[model samples]
Target chain A: MTNAERKRPGRPPGPSDTRDRILAVARELFARNGIDKTSIRAIAAQADVDPALVHHYFGTKTQLFAAAIHIPIDPMDVIGPLKKVPVEDIGRTLPSLLLPLWDSEAGKGFIATLRSLLAGNDPSLVRSFLQEVIAKEVGSRVDDPPGSGRLRVQFVASQLVGVVMARYILELEPFKSLPVEQIVDTIAPNLQRYLTGELPGLS
Target chain B: MTNAERKRPGRPPGPSDTRDRILAVARELFARNGIDKTSIRAIAAQADVDPALVHHYFGTKTQLFAAAIHIPIDPMDVIGPLKKVPVEDIGRTLPSLLLPLWDSEAGKGFIATLRSLLAGNDPSLVRSFLQEVIAKEVGSRVDDPPGSGRLRVQFVASQLVGVVMARYILELEPFKSLPVEQIVDTIAPNLQRYLTGELPGLS
Candidate 1:
């Protein structure tokens, strides 16, 4: 055995090692079979760890998924900052806050998570994350008509999801080549409309 | 062997059987490993056919991909009908014409194609489809600033892709539950704006 292997012989490979192994296995299984179909026991078996260890480390499957995907920031981090701005200004603020992340080094993980969601692995998790976390948080802060807040949040999610998929994931051009400022300038007003604008057909 | 198996045993299992088997294997591999990584030889090997047979049947990898995914309608069918309408009407006409395809029986193939694209299999195919096929065809029909038509088509593509992801794939609520007519009504004007309206920030 190598000196490094001999030194760590009886230590049970450390807590972080076990945690990392479980996460790696979970990510592979989730990517292959999707979030709904992969189970904790299966992940444990693949990782060669006890099932209880998986739960002990990650708490729930959803929590484990979040860990495996490495979602960089809380949705509220994006939504919370915008709450201080006037509702009218949020159109501009929304893209300003969110778009920078897509360009940053940290955004790669976010992109992977988004890609996995697009791949139809645990779509319910994405839906819940958007509705329960992002929409609920932002909706509580925004002053809109009763029950309209969720719809507004959904619209915002759709626009943002589309932009990321086009510009970052699919790399669809002119979008792929355009300066970020130009994209921000163009999309902000539309996002503003979705956030606060009236629906044309609905009362 | 059963009568059905006996009848098909000789003569290379007939044309349709060989073609269907090749396509099925290609779809599975493409979905699993993505387009760039999957090879014709590998697909043939998995399908239990000679490599030459795959080439003889499908002509090229691109053609095989097109056959496997089965994009339901020529994009021109969507673009062609809109051409008869005034250029100004194309925006509103677009969603009216194309969104219904998502909910149709044939749309299953489209959804699969989109999922594969989102999964990062042969993104170039989608890019070329959008640029060479959809944009080229649509741009020829629309009157816009010399270089801006491509950008407009891209914007429309982003919106349509996002809506389908949210409503069909991600199942974001409100969008998921709302009637399709309402979706068309709400989004048609925005698509129209992308199609013909003055972009907010561009000079």
Candidate 2:
């Protein structure tokens, strides 16, 4: 296809479905400033589009934000397959379930988001993220016991967040350079424990 | 003293320090965009001061960040006496040492900074912060032995971060209104265990 004929977003002057570009700018601005501080004007200026176009595309800032930061993976698509897997192996199944996805397209985007979140300069985005992503999903999965599940959930998050912190954010020596599989194998046991192990301090 | 009598940081017609004003603006910007993304220009514009004056007072972004974020408590001074205290009492001593610091003038700023961090706005700030203010000092005090202080250190941080996430960043219901000391006391044992306990599977 000729460059001109190739599908591309219609530029500013009037409305166009420029949600993707708007989202990109929003992510960058939000990463740079924060959700609260990054205004429509800034995003419009950065994206070289009209601000009203952003409203038309995404509706509200929160909706725009949800689109901007949304993990590409549908939670249903991810967790759906595991429903049939026995709860006992849910421990082992958990990491295995997640690894492939994280190794793929949607997961890679999520990983980048995690990396940005680790280093991004916005608080509201991060807080909302922790609740939306980690706390809700990870925190809710506990079946091990009472407090045990909670501890397990927190530990699971800690391990994962720590790993992301070390590997992605800090770029620690071996971890930074390690293959994803290697890191997974090394950390999966901890993941399983948090997922299925007897959580300590539980009655 | 009259406002005019207050020391101005920069030359007129260029930029002014506007210390208190800068601090106020800096807090909002920093909280919104994190330490790095929030720039001198932004702070200047917000404070109605010249950006050059920020350079005159703070010298560099790093220094400015330190001035803006560093809690006044010298970890060395506080941790020094902690070393001399009995091992078993370290848990109790820890909260006493750290809680007051978190509640102090500088500590409040630091906590506010942390609240922003927990919210996920500034990953670099959190990383360096954990490295500089938290990990190094905290790691030095705790060890891996029977009474080694380090295990609980991790727990303390985890617990504290969780509390900050829920209480400050997420602004979840009851947690928001809970007294700090009460909250600290409630979590102290868990912190103690995580700080000092033989975390299963790790050791």
Candidate 3:
């Protein structure tokens, strides 16, 4: 320990370090083991810590699961403004909103986690994540009627996911290497369709 | 066995039984392990037979993997009619078109594979499955302008997956139990929008 480190405070380490450690270990273990099979005690063991340490830190596995798999974006901050963005302008704004994240380090973590679920066999984890996170975070923001939000949100989610699969996961050649700006230009309008376009024949 | 049957049958369950047994074991194992990890030798050991038996029966692990996951639905049979559905009507017909099989035994295998993937952590599996199986099947049928056909196909896939995530995967309360017809009625128009719609502000 550095001479200054030993002199710091009453708790030794501040409260955040324990929580962060648990999440780091949880992500590794959950990736290795199926989510359903990953027990709290197992996560505790993986961390070389006590079960109480996990419970004290995360409370429940579901909550821990949520935290561990959290994407870097704070949905509230990004999406909240989207709801009020004159829904028409959303076509332009939505693509502009996601491009940087899709092209950045933090966004890659989100993409990796999303793509990982798409590649894994446990639909439960992906389903719940979509329901709890995607639905609540993205779907709930739009003021459309109850079910309308799902259609809008799901359509939007699919566009983003499809781009990820084609570009990152499947590594489709042109798209895989496309410059960030070009991709945004190409995909943004389609997303705009999902966000605010009208289907000619039906609605 | 009947006295005549036992005597008339080819040599008492010898090499023939081993081949069939190996195939059965291989099918189950491959379904569980995926093709990458399953080996001819593993199939032989699991079935308590010689490895050469696998070669005799299926020729290769790749062939065996294909056999294990093969479905009754002909890809053309699944996707062919959509070409006739007209892009406008494609949305309404989308769910009703496939939900029967998704509810069928044959469809269940595909669904099981899809469900397994949907449950997993990777988003790409669902994306690829949709692309490989559903999207390619449906999207190829929609002959629109460059981006529209692709976007239309992607939008269709998004709706179906969203429904599965809702009704099957997450088991969302009201949605989980809603009749298929109701779901079709509720969600199809949004799909219709993407299939044959004017870009909201573009038009």
Candidate 4:
């Protein structure tokens, strides 16, 4: 039957409906408390499902976070490889890993979610991911002058985010059509500088 | 009288109403037809006002476009300076001029308009401004390999746009709070590289 027919009153909530409810609750809690402070049990409780079921469906907290944000892949798929890369090489390695993913079909959902998140009142989810996840994972490694790593990653983030905007959103000609490697190679040095260079006020 | 009373139907349309109608028409035409193709007369005609009145209300087509986009300052205020700067200096010159303006009180409206524009279905107005206005102004100067100038400017746009996203929208700490000079100093070399650097595939 059609989705509308299925949604008529007295019908039991389908698995997809339950999953959507779980996702909605997960998004709310994750956005409010952030990835670090938010717990799987809390999301499960709010969704009225067992914690084990949440894990069974979405695997891990980070994975659930990814799904909540409509990112189809696990966060670790990229992060795991990143952990293996040396700090000095992260500049080049990052776009190399990410560009392909962002260029793929799944990337559309991510770009859409990002546009909506930025457009929405609460950018906390995006901020939380950048701060709690990306900063902690990559920023710690680039922390050459003790406490300057976060800012370094942030500068890198600005450029990377801009690339996303130009290529995907603004869809600037030639830029939108440029081969992925061209972009990666062009921005790599700049990203490297941000990660390891002697930036002003960073000492 | 209260704004509600002032907006009452019995009263004749105020100067503000006429100005707003022109701006709304300008925005619609600019978004659909782009800056180069759209004209003051067309916008004035659409708004049912005299073309001279449109010019009186807004100084020039570019100024009208700027107003349509909610940029409080005239577009020429920034573009006029860049016209004099040597190509080599543009990298440093741009952010030095822009960051302060973005940090100013008037920038709030521009940023809001930008957020809404990106969020909306038609990013055409932004695309038009970037392509027709910015690309024509700066891209022509940087066209070292003949046809590569536009792409170069687009890359620069990506980075600059990213800075706006990071500092203003994402509110990344330290990035958001960094002194304007610090940001300018940091991104200048990178911007210069994009402007004149030997980017891959650009030969």
Candidate number with greatest DockQ: 4
Which 10-residue window in model 1 chain A sums to the lowest lDDT?
A: A1-10
Per residue, candidate 4 scores C-alpha lDDT tens digits across B82-169 of: 9899999999999999999999999898789778866856788889999999999999999999998899999999999999999999
Q: Tens-digit lDDT track for model 2 on A5-69?
A: 32545733333335566777898887576566778888989888888878877766655765676
Error of 2 at A71 (Å): 1.6
Report the C-alpha lDDT of model 3 over B86-200, residue by residue, as the tens digit.
Answer: 7678888877777766666766566455544433434343343344445555656653555445555654564565455445544554455556676566557656765666533
Which 10-residue window in model 2 chain A sums to the lowest lDDT?
Answer: A11-20
Distance from true location, Cα of B161 in model 2, Å: 4.3
Higher TM-score: candidate 2 or 3? 3
Better structure of 2 and 4 per DockQ: 4
* B132 Cα displacement, candidate 2 (Å): 6.5
TM-score, cand. 1: 0.73
iRMSD per model? Answer: 1.6, 7.0, 6.7, 0.9
Candidate 3 chain B has its poorest 10 consecutive residues by lDDT at B118-127
* Model 2 spans with C-alpha error above 4 angstroms: A1-67, A77-108, A111-167, A170-203, B1-69, B85-105, B111-141, B145-163, B172-203
Clashing pairs in 1: none
Tell how far residue B122 is off in model 2, in angstroms: 9.7
- Model 3: per-residue lDDT, tens digit, A77-184? 466677677755765666677767777887776666664454443445555555555566556655355455555555555456556545555443344665666555
Please name the candidate that would achieve the greatest TM-score relative to the true structure: 4
Screening candidate 4 with a backbone cut-off below 3 angstroms (N, C-alpha, C), the clashing residue pairs are none
- Write candidate 2's Cα lDDT for B106-184 as tens digits: 6666656554443455445555545444445565666665333333354355445545444443454344555556545
lDDT by residue (B80-159, candidate 1, tens digit) is 68768888788778888767888888787888877877776767656666766577778666536667888888888888
Clashes of each: 0, 14, 23, 0
Report how far residue A91 has shifted in candidate 3, in Å. 5.8
